[model samples]
Target chain A: MTDEQRRRRGRPRSEQAHDAVLAAARELLAEVGYARLTIEGVAARAGVGKTTIYRWWSSKAELVAEILYRPISIEEIPESGSPRDDLAANIRLIVEPFTDPWYGPALTGARNDLNADPEGQKAFQAQIMSGRRDTGRAVFQRLVDAGDLPPDTDVDYLIDVMSGLLVYRGAIWRQPITEEDVRKLVALLVDGRPPRRTPS
Target chain B: MTDEQRRRRGRPRSEQAHDAVLAAARELLAEVGYARLTIEGVAARAGVGKTTIYRWWSSKAELVAEILYRPISIEEIPESGSPRDDLAANIRLIVEPFTDPWYGPALTGARNDLNADPEGQKAFQAQIMSGRRDTGRAVFQRLVDAGDLPPDTDVDYLIDVMSGLLVYRGAIWRQPITEEDVRKLVALLVDGRPPRRTPS
Candidate 1:
């Protein structure tokens, strides 16, 4: 509908090529794990030249991360009238990918493999983790501005607490997180359990 | 002294030898890394026979885990007649080994290495993680029993939330956790904000 769409010539070819490379990368990563994956292998499997891969991404880690991240980042947190609803929805949205049975394990294997690779670690921390925090911070800031959260709230710690709890349950325990768990956590963040004092 | 303490001649030698082996294992795990460390290396460093190392432990992973865990497990959360105090103390105690500049990183590296070792994973979950849950459960049970927390409180999820947040900050961020952070988390768990009500 736009001028770019009407005039675009090489765009479709590039889009098709990008999709091919990503599909190949995903398949190869699942089959061989992250450490064994090579750009050459992905390029060959995707039937695209190695230069096609490098044109978009500088390194293998970058390519893998780019391939893995959804078009919509965690920044697009869902919003409802109430803070509680928005928070719960936000948690599920972010957590869904990491806990996915098939995709999740593959991504985790890639992440664990990055532990020793300084370049991979830097990219992961910079691109993935940093993006997560910034997105969540923006969402929390909106909530605070809308008067849903208190003005005095420490948004940084709050984000850490919420994400940390979710990661702990999902990644470490490998447990199936329940709807009830999410509800209670968001509820706890909003309302604390005041200790009972002596009868007055 | 008890009869067992007084009557054992070989027990004393074995105890001395056990201490030496553990000390050496701890030292090496710090200097090198889990992947490069071996039982034979630990034995030589401890000035003991390989059989001495094998007498009590079955594998290198088991040996490392044993050498690391203190007699007082994390489940033995402290009590101070208050949920706030108890929770703060519990967080510090559990997080101590992970954040220690020397002892902690080595243990963590060993844990990371356990990803490839199914035996090590099981041992860690059963001996360490389970123990943490049980110990914290007993502590929370006391709090609930005393009516500090609501009887319907989900203790299991609560434990996960607390520990998960602490781990996310300490292990992942590698940030310095302050006393204030611990206190605030415990306070949040204790006192939730009252839900807003519509005016009649």
Candidate 2:
């Protein structure tokens, strides 16, 4: 091959290896679930060396986190007139994917796995969490622009509390956050209303 | 041995075995952590049969959960006159232990492990979570009775949200819930106030 072609070969070959490793990791994750899946297995399946996988991802948890960090785009959030409905819908949209029969267990399983790997968790927070927060910022900003939330709303803190509620309920508790619960959270956090008893 | 003596021996022997297993499990957890700890190790350490351990606890997760479920008694909650301070203190009392360097990783690790064992999770919920909720109820009720929280407030839902925040922040995010954050949560949940910008 010509020198020019040989030089060009390196970039695409590395890209191909990257895609192959991710695809193999995803497939194996689905096949074996997170507990049984391993870096060695991903390497062997992807036809890459263990170091290649390790170079990109610190552990199976990080690998799985990348696979699961598909953010809900701005377009996905519904444009209902009421901001409360929109906000609650946005929350469900972001969190409900975790409740899927396939994703729920896998997500929680991977989350727990991440706890053991602090470096991987930091990488995940830097990359995946920051991306997720950006999406939250956009959604909350829309509410502010529309005069739904007060101008002085602490969006960052809101994001943190909302995120905590979502993960704590959906992933940790292993239960669906009901519509009433969503309404209560939004009302309390955004509207600053105490949880009122629903008249029987 | 006399028949009466032999019959009496059975009850004390079983009780001793139970105490021994719990002690062994707690010690082993401190040594190996939740991920590497096993029923076999617990049984061997306790000098009990594996079946004996299994008979009492379904999985290592349940055993660890039991070891970690030491609740703060009502007496432990400080009697600060302000209900909000009392409430925040109560929250810290309940959640801060999990943040113990020795307990934090192990608790999160076991929590994830529990996700894989549904029956164990149910037992944890039924026994541990319910007991926790009861404590929360007492605290909230005391607040209401003190003319602090409104009597119409839903304590159960409050408990859930507070719990979500605690686990989400402490265990999941691996961050200390700051005093400011606690004040905000208490004010927002109890007094219905939006998050205000802290003075720069």
Candidate 3:
């Protein structure tokens, strides 16, 4: 094969198309919500053929999931610091995307669409939560190594409870989970002590 | 006007149509879920015209909400017993609808639909949770009166944590919040005591 042909084959139009598709998806999701969004619309918005979108993301849910969660990687949460401090920071980072003006509405829309179908919700969680859980596992392991947590503390259950608390408040009650609440929750679970009664 | 005409005016076909509409909606919701349900479908299934449904209910959301949650009145949870036992029982009762085979699927579908639209979610929560919160308020007040909870215990926050834990486990994790889990949570928060660790 010629050198030019080999180079062209290695770096195809797929890369540029991938970025454009994702960008268009993010913008359109914020505007329309998942219920009204269609793959055709996404393709048109991205200035790509429908075949190009289909080549990468098989479905709208898959594309939207990637768009909302692409920024959340295990490395974003550092586990080397004090366990409580690290946990608090890590949680803040995890929630940052959900609080973003652009990402928040899109995610809410995407989530509602995914949630309606049980199968879609399962797949989305498996794809997104697996990496997030690994990060949480690392923090728990660090806490164990530092003797900040009980040796046999169930890491997965603890993570579930912590995140569940935040999500429940945000989604169900539409209430903002304050940093103070996070701090208290972490401290209480770790220390097993209720704060001394403050005069009301 | 004739007495019969006056009686018909006072108690129109809306009375019978209301019951039939709710029943059919509940059945269809479980069968096809909220995403697939439609007013026309429910009306057809109930053997009633669309006008009857529209007259009694402004929208499908209002009708569905009433059908699934009509049973969750404040007095349904009895408060005659000890606070801890009563609280646990009340929690179990509160979750009963979500766990029922018939009602659970419908509520899940309804929730997914409501959660996507911010305005709809707000109205549903306000209309539904207002009464539910009253029941919770009664339970907390009883606990406080009986000295089961500390005077300075942030009741609202505590309740949020408790329900959030359950919801997180149920909605996000898709895990059952078992009776034992509820009991342990209630006990742990009330006692503020960490479990004794078994030697590994």
Per-residue lDDT tens digits for candidate 3, residues B1-200, read 99988886788676868888988988887788766789999999999999988886666776787776664555766766788877787677656556545454455556655655567666766777777777776777687788877676666666676676766666445577776676656665566533323422
**Model 1 TM-score?**
0.79
In terms of DockQ, which candidate is stronger, 2 or 3? 2
Top-lDDT structure, candidate number: 2
Residues B1-200, candidate 2: write the lDDT tens digits: 99987876777778989889988988887797778888999999999999998898888888888878765566776567777777888887766666666577777677777777778889888987787777788888888898777778878777777877777677666678777878877877787776666531
Give the C-alpha lDDT of model 2: 0.78
DockQ of each: 0.35, 0.45, 0.31
lDDT of 1 by residue, B136-198 (tens): 777777767777677777777778777778877876556777777776776666555422212
> Clash pairs of candidate 3?
none
Q: Where does model 3 sit among the CAPRI classes? A: acceptable
lDDT at residue B105 of model 1 (Cα atoms): 44
Model 2: which residue pairs collide?
none
Task: Answer with 1 or 2, whichever has the higher DockQ.
Answer: 2
Q: Please give the range of 10 consecutive residues that has the lowest summed lDDT in model 2 chain A.
A: A191-200
